[model samples]
Target: MRLRNCLYHFAPYGFHATWHHLATTHHIPGRIESNPSSLVRALDELETARALMLPRAVAFAAQRRLQKREGRRVPAALHPWDSWGCHDIAYCPDPQKHPAEPLPVVVDRVLGACAAGTDRAGRCLVCGREDWDLWRVCQNCGVASGGRGAHH
Candidate 1:
């Protein structure tokens, strides 16, 4: 789960390690990694492994919790962070300074301060349109005759 979170949060950097760990630890029986279908099938069922395994972990923990409660302990209700420790995944980089990096659109807008004349038109890597006042269609597609897509 820590591996999955690392992969999910850090993306490209941690993916290799996460993949290696997953491939080694949770390898499916007689499956080939080269097969996209096999990979897809395994990826699709990752939650099933969690569904099966987590309950058992929780149950075992629950027993400890129960005993602890009886032993004058407060029952830990399994806070979401309990599984992964104190690692709260947060967007570390300031998007305003490094807007080139791909980001979650919602948070990206906030971090990039989208309203401070950070026009999507100018930031369009495909098109180069600085003056948002004059152009409705992007420069890449219109004036520049470039074929970059809408979001590219």
Candidate 2:
């Protein structure tokens, strides 16, 4: 009932998926009481949400899959939660003020290089093919090599 009550407030797919997960995993008994109409409504809501972001979502999904194939970390997708409470501050790096180089920052830089396929001498991010002669379309999405979230 709580879920049904909440479902009325939003599109239905999010509600249904959320409800199904809650019911099956958390064993919420009220989900069983929820009717098929509610499930259909939830899916309709999902379709609308999907429509709003179809182009961007498809690109992000493709890039992520391509990154996985090449054994690289997909650059993190910036969801709303990524910047919840952060103050926007300018970077002021003073070598004199902070003597100790942060190890994690250094490691992150190294990891970023690896993710971009730069360390191994121009390795393609999508497919593992080396030289241009072997090149067809980028193993990544058909979008330009760097276009990650253009639609968003």
Candidate 3:
């Protein structure tokens, strides 16, 4: 169903809005009722992002469990859960600047770009632009990237 592209997952932003944004950015249609199979693009992106997040999530969970056992009330990783489902989440400040690439590829590029120890300093996590402002929104892509660390 067309509504499959519009879902409300347990993410920080409603996944429906995120899906619509991504769909529109990627030139995907809002109504797939005509063919029905066109809905796969949005779902594929979501699934890929989930696949990328799963390992980190599991490790984070294990770390949290260890911390609990160690009597650490707060997560030492700093807002570890704040980024839940942030991959491809609704942070597109400038639709035109959002990459036309897939979500996993964008994430990988951002990871590599930020690997030089620039956690929130140089590039836009989503768009790979070097136009971050005060709140870390990319002037190029308009993504409030939550910083490279959070975005990744």
Best lDDT goes to which candidate?
Answer: 3
True lDDT of residue 101, candidate 1: 21
The candidate with the higher TM-score, 1 or 2, is: 1
- Pairs with steric clashes in candidate 2: 12-42, 12-45, 13-42
Question: Which clashing pairs does model 3 show?
Answer: 93-142
User: What is candidate 3's lDDT per residue for 36-94, written digit by digit as tens?
Assistant: 45457666666676566566556767776788899979545433333453333424544
Better of 2 and 3 by lDDT: 3
lDDT of 2 by residue, 1-152 (tens): 44456434431112333344334433444545655455545444434433443344456567768899999976764332112111100011221221122222322332344346473455433333354211222333221122212223
Order the candidates by TM-score, highest first.
3, 1, 2
TM-score of each: 0.26, 0.25, 0.67
Q: Report the error of model 3 at residue 34, Å.
A: 0.4
| Candidate 2 deviant stretches above 4 angstroms | 1-17, 20-34, 61-77, 80-152
* lDDT by residue (tens digit), candidate 1, 1-152: 34355445332112343244335434533446444454444354443333333443455567766787788665543222223311211111221222222223222332233235444444432233355322233333221111112113
Error (Å) of candidate 3 at residue 14 is 6.4
With candidate 1 superimposed using the best TM-score fit, by how many Å does residue 26's alpha carbon deviate from the native? 13
